[model samples]
Target: MTRHPTEHPQFYLTAPAACPYLEGKQERKVFTHLIGKHAPTLNDVLTHGGFRRSQNIAYRPACEDCRACVSVRVCVAEFKWTKSLKRQWKLGQDILGARLPTSPSSEQYDLFKSYLATRHENGGMTDMSVLDYAMMIEDTHVDTMVLEYRSKGPDSFITGIGQGPLLGVALTDQLCDGLSMVYSFYDPDFDGIGLGTYMILDHIVRAQKLGLPYVYLGYWVDGSPKMTYKVRFKPQEHLGPDGWAKVD
Candidate 1:
């Protein structure tokens, strides 16, 4: 049975929890399930309205007293590579990223565990098990892909695929106007390679090739060092009460 895109979804609000980005603040989220035949279209519409996808759910910040988590999207047509970004891009030249079906693998889960232990040991995802990681990758109802970055192999030039160890992974959603990056993690040992930044740059290039206008970067908090990186991409638009407004 086909579901109509015009059908309204039932939204729910999450209980207040400690804010991850801001200290001493509580955070809440208003979310709805993304499922059925209209999932892709609904995901696109909700994303345009500042919602982000996670597994089978679409959510946006609904904090009581704070609006720090602002949705940001890179203007692909206007993005320019700075010297630092160019260097970062070059640094990852030995890495090959390929978009694959959202299938869970023990290899990817191992990498995820290592990344959380090294980078986000104290975060909410620290306790995630292999099953949990699998759910994160496979529970999506909308159009999704897992981009796996690995060290380039000898046959990479001919096959156009990476080999050996996984360097990074990005769980992304395909939207009508852009690619929404759901979550990304990298091998902490390659921190100097700036895998995270390189992934974003690659996404922008991919978006440009596909003639997409934006690359949804989830949210950017003003004072959160963890999220400050999102702002470095120039010509980005931030969602506000007036809708998406261009940020200098």
Candidate 2:
């Protein structure tokens, strides 16, 4: 009898497209669907192999020439914040993040629209509609969550939830050994508190409290100014041919 390996997923590659992080370059991606009961396990394995999760798909850059997209994960146990990072954390103490269900809301959609308009005007997600946003949140099969950040309420310590206008949101995945940050967006108009930096710092603290050793920060592209912030959370490992190794 002949049998096919249904447990193993098939991967497909996309046609080359303009590289978002670099000019005069093209990029392609190899991707597979994560589905069924084995999704969480599959996600963990693929993540450690330098692939990133998006909704229900796992993908990694497969450029023919450029090798600039490097996966990064912070060593949470050994993470040490610089004075600047500390300041940013302290300034944003009023904000709290709580893991909420993947249900989409009008408020979230409004903020998401504003963020895309201001921060990613010409980017791929610029045209995302509310239904698309809903799909992004609800289409996942792995162990995923939506961490919504807002002003801490009087009962925040007891409830582990926040109140007030939403400030930031991170779509994260809980892996066996770490938390993989799938994607994050924040209020671009909010000033002084460093909302972007605070969300990451909070994730590290959450990982530490949960006894997770790493906080995956997604791909870090060399020469991408936007990606430079990922390196600031020092004592991080970059995935390379030799596997994960300290780069900072």
Candidate 3:
């Protein structure tokens, strides 16, 4: 009997639900638990093929007859920083970011709770408890890391301890080709300084320094104003039926 390589993935499809990005639409997802020894390698391959990791489950939109959501990745080597992007870079200069292993902490959770309460109060994760938050950070089965953003300090050791209040957090996955930004949140009070954009910009620079090719930015829905910002990162490639196509 012939066996498929993915036979061991234990895939499942989510029940149809109302689409958050598009009006009068429904959405479904094909997902699987990314655990066990092969999880890291499988996740890398899966993400390159358009899957996104959320905690331990890797999922992709599987809504019938709908193709509005497209996966995006920035070509770090080819990216050109716009004038506005440069300004954002300077704005975030006072911020120090530390990439650490996938572990949970009350300090991080406090910032996460505040961010959700302020920005995603009506979203699915709004009701998540501290336990839920811990699981979200520590349940990963792949090569994932959490980047903690804080105010820069006078010394590296002080920076490692991260002085001042937590400013932002990014859950990221390192793949063979690039880094996939699983999720990110920040202090809404810092919104005016463009922390969100600056995070992505920093990821691009991080990717370049890591000798990686791309920085996967998850999905981009064409008409969704909420997701429009993902498109502003120029020289990005959108995954389509024909394969990865560059969007100028």
Candidate 3: stretches off by over 4 Å: 1-7, 157-161
- The lDDT for every candidate, in the order shown, is 0.91, 0.91, 0.88
Q: Write the per-residue lDDT of candidate 3 for residues 133-175, one digit (tens) a residue.
A: 8898899878889998888877856546466888999999999
Question: Mind giving the per-residue lDDT tens digits that candidate 2 earns over 1-248?
Answer: 64433268899999999999998999999999998878889999999999999888899999999999999999999999899999999998888899998888888888899999998999999989989999998999888889999999999999998899989999999999999999889999998888888999989999999999999999999988978888899899999989999977
Write model 1 residue lDDT over 1-248, tens digit each, in one string: 86654377999999999998899999999999898888999999999999999898999999878988899999999998889999999998889999899998988888889999998889999989888999999998888999999989999899878999888899999899999999999898976678889999989988999999999999999889999889889999999999999997
lDDT of 1: 0.91
Q: Which stretches of candidate 2 lie over 4 Å from their true place?
A: 1-6
* Residue pairs with backbone atoms closer than 3 Å in model 2 (clashes): none
The total of clashing pairs for model 2 equals 0
**For each candidate, what TM-score against the reference?**
0.96, 0.96, 0.94
Clashes of each: 0, 0, 0
Q: Global lDDT for candidate 3?
A: 0.88
